[model samples]
Target: MDFEKLLVWQRAKALAVSLYKELANCGDVAFKSQITRSGLSVPSNIAEGMERFTNTEKRRFLSIAKASCGELRTQIMIGGEIGYIPALLADRWINETREISKMLSGLINRISD
Candidate 1:
């Protein structure tokens, strides 16, 4: 099965939507926008990468996706610091992000080998 078809990606997309909702109305508009931007980047990159016809293109996009996840992780931490998000919720998102990053990395490594 195509990695793109994985339910994790679907869940990630759903999760990102919820995340945006949570961040959008939060106080501090600038920080909210930044967090929302980084949060959306994960699935956006994945969808773009999955659409590519070439493996190299897919790999490159996955790399970008992974990087965005890292960015999201940092934004989330800062969100927590600023009281934008609760620790429990932040931990949950971070774990999911890390899992997705690992999955993408595994797939990319397999492609390279």
Candidate 2:
């Protein structure tokens, strides 16, 4: 249950790091802040959830992380459509978020069982 050992957590962390680097040169402060915050939240929540003592607490945090995945995907899409993000890069981010969301679902279900 260690977050570091989780592939989803690792990807989420890498995504956040890449996002921060990508947004570093962005001229839109609002967009940059929103995406980066949500991106960071994914891994942060996963780690925090995995550290919880109860399944309920872990599920709650995982749910939040999943929600953040959705939020980040939306932001990435918008950024792409608006030309702030490259299409290929945005697509990659969206796909990664989707995978992370799925992973979180599996983890949540396993914890519930």
Candidate 3:
């Protein structure tokens, strides 16, 4: 399957782009870099996983992508708590990551079967 054709991947990619733009003016460089890296990883891993020949490899990458969702969520929460990211923006990202994680889980299950 084409990764770009997957809704999960599409959403993840959009979230990553949004994050990059949102965090562009953030003064906390370290936090910004970390969150952005995880945001980027979601789609990157999904694409790499989908292109793999084996279901196991694909699932592995998908799992990584899913984990990155949690990582990104945590970062967003921390950023919001520390005033680095606005509450509304953090809430949006948190929700997006949650959806992405669920989508990844469904994909993983499909592949497993």
Better-scoring candidate (TM-score), 1 or 3 = 3
What is the TM-score of each predicted model, taking all chains together?
0.88, 0.97, 0.97
Clashes of 3: 0
Checking candidate 1 for backbone clashes, the offending pairs are none
lDDT of 1 by residue, 1-113 (tens): 45458664675687689788777668788887877787788888888877888889888987998898889888888887777898899888888888878987886786651
Clashes of each: 0, 0, 0
Per-residue lDDT of 48 in model 1:
83
After superposition, candidate 1 runs with Cα above 4 Å error: 1-4
Report the C-alpha lDDT of model 3 over 1-113, residue by residue, as the tens digit: 99999999999999999999988998878888999999999999999999999999999999999999999999999999999888998898899999999999999999963
Candidate 2 regions with alpha-carbon error over 4 angstroms: none
- Give the alpha carbon lDDT tens digit for every residue of 11-38 in model 2: 9999999999988999999989999999
> What is the overall TM-score of model 3 with all chains considered together?
0.97
User: How close is each model in CA RMSD to the real structure?
Assistant: 1.9, 0.8, 0.9
